[model samples]
Target chain A: MNVFVVGVGLIGGSFALDLKELNSNVIIHGIDINESHLQEAMELGVIDQKSSYENLSLADVVVISIPVNAANEVVPRVLDAVHEDAVVIDTGSTKAPLCELLVNHPKRRNFLAAHPIAGTEFSGPSAAHVGLYAGKTNIICEVEKTAFKLQERALKIFSDIGMRIRYMDPKSHDRHIAYVSHLSHISSFMLGKTVIEKERNERDIFDMAGSGFESTVRLAKSSPAMWTPIFQQNKENVLETLDEYISNLLLFKSYLEKDDFQAIFSAMESTNKIKEILNGIVVKPI
Target chain B: MNVFVVGVGLIGGSFALDLKELNSNVIIHGIDINESHLQEAMELGVIDQKSSYENLSLADVVVISIPVNAANEVVPRVLDAVHEDAVVIDTGSTKAPLCELLVNHPKRRNFLAAHPIAGTEFSGPSAAHVGLYAGKTNIICEVEKTAFKLQERALKIFSDIGMRIRYMDPKSHDRHIAYVSHLSHISSFMLGKTVIEKERNERDIFDMAGSGFESTVRLAKSSPAMWTPIFQQNKENVLETLDEYISNLLLFKSYLEKDDFQAIFSAMESTNKIKEILNGIVVKPI
Candidate 1:
């Protein structure tokens, strides 16, 4: 099996590692605009060879894991090059735009739009490791658009890697992800900004910060090159979520200003239901 | 040595566990308004006995781990009731108001205003565990006001439990914590609230939520009874941090509205420096 991974970074590199571990016959090919990432991934044994889109014709599986904006352009080109028998999947955060872009393509059946709900705040090939997708959820948007056999092929690989799959329409995928994924990233980034801005005055604030602060601000360390395009591609839904979040913050602030301890307490108490919802996620042990 | 813990919940119970482990001669006496908490703590061995203020005069150490508002009322009372040799330390989130309330007390020198920058989102006696304070910071405000011998006794226990200590004026502690600690809680609670409110329309939004969302919203699960008072006591600084955080969010929203991807990218890139800042704090492995 020829597994070709485009833009080999954290997501792509991890996928390559896992695939090779699953099958001794699998030969992994790495392609990235950043030549250093390909070299590093190869050094780390994440891939067997350095290759390009020109060589994608040899691929039995092509996985595109790049920034959402780049995925929009590169995915179609890769789809154009790959054989009809090959399964081409792009693992980007947003779905609706890319699904729409490829809807009219003749080889639309060869492509699968997937968002693996997994990552740390780190990036690049060095940050990649095996089992990254273990027990994690993967949202497959417009699954019906992909060919039946190709879907089966992708599903086989996904199952082998320990990922749980869910099917959803592209529009709903983007809207719901805006709340669960994108909004959290924005809130975390702004938190890092607000605290860094204050560190100019309080140099010791970091000393006072505990693991809780670290957990809350973890997303602030994500790659901007990857996330900026996501926030841009899903602008409408992201904006809606942001407005709602800001409104909630303002209401909490108003409660504080008025010294309405009861209201503030009630707001947090209601949100405490998130404890059970979060339990649905498989939290890896420390 | 007799150790009395008032409000035998997460912090207080954890302290009792670590203190008991430090010496076989140590006896932990639990005190709480809630009879069930005291019973539970005794059953869990988080406390060896159940006692009260009437028995506090026999205490060599008294750790107050309740809400800030309750701390303001109970800390001075404990100070008045304890022997001159007993070290009375109140571990609340806010420090300024508590320190101010005790500055003129007849037993002021026996009281220490210390905030342990440690805890999980869960509370109550069951959440208590040994080594909870290991490798975490404990902020000691107005340490100079504490009796030298009493301070030594408290420092001895802190060192035994592997806690790092830093001295800060109570006013500065409250102000800095508003940015790093209080603001993060409010942001997390709001993020949880925003996604939850949307869940009313899209019930499966949580299915798309991943560990990142879990990390960012973890603090939202904190007890309302605990945090409401922190916000109340530190209202001025919390409001200041809120204004700055909301402004940052609004500015990021404006960039999105105008499709200014460069600004968005740069904003996140600058904040990525928090990566280094966060690294300075020891991250426990997962």
Candidate 2:
């Protein structure tokens, strides 16, 4: 099997490594506009060779893992280059825009829209690892649009990487991810901004940041290059989640102002249910 | 040496274990308003014996690890019970109100306002473990007020627990923590609350919560009993931090609404500097 990976950065690079581990016959090809990333991926042995869109037809599988904005333009071109029996899939964070672009395409069945709910805050080819997707959730959107054999092959690849799969429509995928994933990045980025603006002394922040602060602010370290496009593509749902989040913060602030310790206590106690929900998530041990 | 811990919960219980690991001659006595916690500490071998406020005079060192509201009242009484040669230190998050309480006390020299900047979301004696303070920061406030001899004793204990110490005024301690610690907790709690309120399906939350969401919301699982008093005592600083955080969120929301992807990109890129600051934090590996 031949796999051609677009945007050979963290997700794509990691997919290359995991795929090679799953099948001895698998040959991975790297494709990235950034020449350095492609070179780094090859040096790191993440790919067996470098390939371009012109030769994408030779790939048994082509995975799109670029920033969502570029992905909007690139997914169609990759689909056009692939053969009828070949499968093309995306690991982008937002699905609706890309799904819309391919809705009426001639080779739409060759494409599968997937968002593997996995990643670290770090990026680049250097950040890729073999087990990055282990025990993580992989959301497949508009699965019924894909051909049956291609779906089976895609499922085999996801399973080989140790992912649990769920199916949802593109609209629902955008809404849910806006809450569960995209909003988290915004909250964390804003948190970092607020702290950096207020606490000018970086030494003070270093001395006082406990594990809780580190964990809460960890996502702020994520690459802006990858995330900005995701927020742009899913703006409506992201805005809705932000509205609810800001309102919740304001209500909690009012409780603080009123010195309503009871309300504050009850509010936090209610959110403690998140612990139970999080425990059920199959995230790999960090 | 005999150490009497006023609250045999997370902080106090963990401190007792670390202290015993440091000194073979050290004897720990558990004290808590809640009988189950006291009993649990004894069962967990976290303390040599169980004691009470009535027996506080027997302690050579009294560590007040209770909630801030309770600490303000309990510290004076514990100071009164102990001999002049003894030391009384607290591991509370807020320092200003407690420092104010002891400003004119007869035994002020024996009380050290210390906030060990370490903890996890879970609480109780069951959550206590040795090395919880290893490589973490311990903030000592109003150090000049502590008698020279007692200060040495308190420093020795903190050092024994593998902590790096920093001295600051109580006002500064509260203000710094309001940004680094208290605000993170509030953000996480509200994030959890907003998601839970919007996503009615628990299964969906379980399915979609990636490691980023888990990290951002981890502090929402913290005990309300422990945090409510910390926020209440540091209400002014907490409110100030909340105001800035909400303003930042509102600005980001406006950018999202306007579809200003460039501004959003720059904001996140700027905050990515937090990754450097966090890298300097010496968190002990779990």
Candidate 3:
């Protein structure tokens, strides 16, 4: 398979590496607006060679792994350029706007709006790894709109990369992901800001931070370029979840202020069910 | 050296294991209000045997490692019961209240208020490990009140357990800890609640959650019995920090609501300084 991956950062780079590993005959062509990332991805062996957008005509599969805002704009262009037989799929955090943009395209059946539910706080080609997608979910939104053959090929690629598949509409995918992924990023970024502003001593924070702090603040390290448009695209769901999250924090604060240990304890105990839920998934080693 | 440990749960049980590991001649006598924990501690080799408070007379060191409320209530009693030569130390999250309780005691000089900056979400004797304290800080508050000779013995035990020492006033420790440690627990617990409430399907959360979500919500699994009293004891500081945290979240939410891409990007970008702060801490391998 000759795979063309645009914006060869963490997700695209990792996909390129996996493609190379899975089949020696597979050739990965990399593309990125950032020249340094393209250089790094090539130097890191993430792709066979750099390719022009015009060359999408020769590709078997084309992955648009740019930021959500860029994906909505760029994926349609890639769809116009790609061969009729080429499958054009996007790996973006938000799916609705991108899905809506490509819904009326002539090659709409060639496009699959996908979100590979995997990544670390780290980014760029340097942060890519072969097994980044393993044991994680890959949500394919509005799969029925994709051509049957393209959908089958996309499923095979995901399965080969060790991801479980879930099907949902673009609207549900956007809403669910905003709660599960986008809100976590905002919560983490805000948490990081609070601690940094309140405690200026980086050394004190370094010494005192335990695993709990690391996990809560991990998403703070995510790229602003990648996340900003995600929040924008999924603004409604993000706002709703943020309201509930703040309300929960306020209620917890009131309980603490009143020295209401029973309320505090019960609330925490109820949330402790997360332990059972988390145990069912494969979390990265702490 | 003989050590008598009261409340043989997570911290005390781990201390016992480390003490026995450091010296073949060291014997750890356990005391717990929970008979099951005491039995499990002995069975798990965390302690040599169950012992009474009267055993404080025979111990060279007495470690009060119970819940924060209980620690404040019990440390003074143990100080009264211990031999004049025994060093009485309480490991609790909040120090000002515990220090206040011990200030007028007859053996006030023998009582040290310490908080070992180490713990896992797991509780009870079975959670104890021989190296749990290795490379962690053991913050001693109101240490000036401890006699030089008792301090010497206490220092040796902490050193044997492989903990670095830091000294602070009780009030200062409580204030700083409210920002660094207590706030993290609240953030994690509330995040868990917010997600669990909004996303009703536990299985979907389990399937979709990545390492970032796991880290942010990890502390939610902590024992409410242990955390509730700490929040109560340090209510003012915890509430103040929580208010700041919620305010920060609200500000970020406002940015998202307005679709202010640049502001959202810059806000998160500024918080990325945590990368430098968190990069230094060695997260214990799971």
Candidate 4:
């Protein structure tokens, strides 16, 4: 099977690696605007051959994993190039913009909007590894809009590689993801910002940090190139999550100011339910 | 050597476990108002005997690892009970209040205000483990107040168990830790609260959460009983950190509102320095 992995970075490269490891017949063709990433992907064995949009016609399955803005712009072109039987999957964090952009496209049936909820903070092909998506939830938006046969083939492949797919509409997907995924990145980034700002005054402040600080700020290390477009496309939903999050933090600060230890303790104790909720999803080491 | 571990839980129990493992001659006597913890600590072999305050005179070393509020109230009593030769080390998160409380105690020369910057979110005797302090930083406060002989005996044992100590004044330790440790717990607990509040409307929101959310929210699972008192004792410093942190969050929210992706991107880029800062510390699994 011919697998075309565009972007040739973390998500695309890891998917290709897992596909290749699972199916020996799969040949991955790497396509990235950045020649260096393509070169690195090939050297890492993340792809078998470096290819481009011109060769996308040979693709049995085309995986587009780029910045969300780029995916919004390039996915229609990818759908136009692939055969009617071929499935083009774009793994972008936001779904609404791309889905809306592709709504009137001729080959909308061939395009699948998938946001695989899995990743480490690192980026690029060197950061790619097999089993990145194993036991992780893959949110598939507007699956019914895609051809049933294409959905079956794509879902089978995802399931084979250890991903469990949950179907939802693009609108719900964007709004929900703004909370669980995008807001997490924002919270982490801001937490990092607050501490970095304080570091100017306190030279050894970081020395006092422990595992708690490390875990909370881990996502601040994510690739801004990829995340910038996400925050842009989903700006409205992202803004809403940030507002709610900031207000919640303000409430906590008020509790602290008033010396209401009971309220503070209750708030944390209730949130402790996240432990039970988190148990439902397996957490990989950050 | 006889070591009395008061309020034997995660910190106290782990210290005893490490002390016993490192110095086989040491016998740990567990003391807690909660007798079940003492029974469990004995079962876990975290302590050799279940004893109380009356037996503290026999202690060569006394570790007070209870909550901060409890530490402030009980530490002076522990110091009064222990012999001048017995070093009493309080491993509470906040240092200033307890140090101030023991400032005029005649046995102050035997008291060491230590805040070992090592822990996992889980609590209780079962969470106790050997090597919990290996490769972790321990911040000691008001070191000079303790006699040189007692300091040497305590620091040597901590070093033998693979802990690196950095001395800071009690006020600076409380303030810096508020920025690094206390604020981290607040951010996590509030993030968990924001998401859980939304969960009332969105049942499957957590399904979309990936390792990012898991890592950012990990500390929300920490013991509220342990944290409440820390916040109570360090109210002023914790409140200051929270104000700075909330302002930063609001600034990010404003950038998101105004469509300033560049500012947002630059903020995160600068904060990405936390990756380097965090690299200096070995992060244990949350």
Q: Which pairs of residues collide in candidate 4?
A: none
Per-candidate interface DockQ score = 0.85, 0.87, 0.75, 0.83
Alpha-carbon runs more than 4 Å astray in model 1: A283-286, B283-286
Question: What docking class should model 1 receive?
Answer: high
Docking class of 2: high
User: What fraction of the correct interface contacts does each predicted structure contain?
Assistant: 0.87, 0.92, 0.78, 0.86
Per-prediction TM-score, please?
Answer: 0.98, 0.98, 0.97, 0.98
Q: Candidate 4: where are CA atoms >4 Å away?
A: A283-286, B283-286
- Against the unseen true structure, what C-alpha lDDT does each candidate score? 0.92, 0.91, 0.86, 0.88
- Candidate 3's residue-wise lDDT over B1-286, tens digit each? 8899998988898898888877889889999999998998988999998999876788889888889998877887888788888898888888999888777888999888888888778999988887888888889987888999999999988887788888888888888888878898998899889989987754564566677788788889999999999999999999888999999998888777777789998998898878888877764423
The order by descending lDDT is: 1, 2, 4, 3
TM-score of chain B of each: 0.98, 0.97, 0.96, 0.97
Per-residue C-alpha lDDT of model 4 across residues B19-54, encoded as one tens digit per residue? 988778999999998999899999989999999889
The residue-level lDDT of candidate 4 at B242 comes to 87
Model 3 chain B is weakest, by summed lDDT over 10 consecutive residues, at: B277-286
Q: What is the lDDT of residue A194 in candidate 1?
A: 95
User: Of the candidates numbered 2 and 3, which has the greater TM-score value?
Assistant: 2
With a 3 Å backbone cut-off (N, CA, C), the pairs that clash in candidate 3 are none
Q: Which ten residues in a row have the lowest lDDT in candidate 2 chain A?
A: A199-208
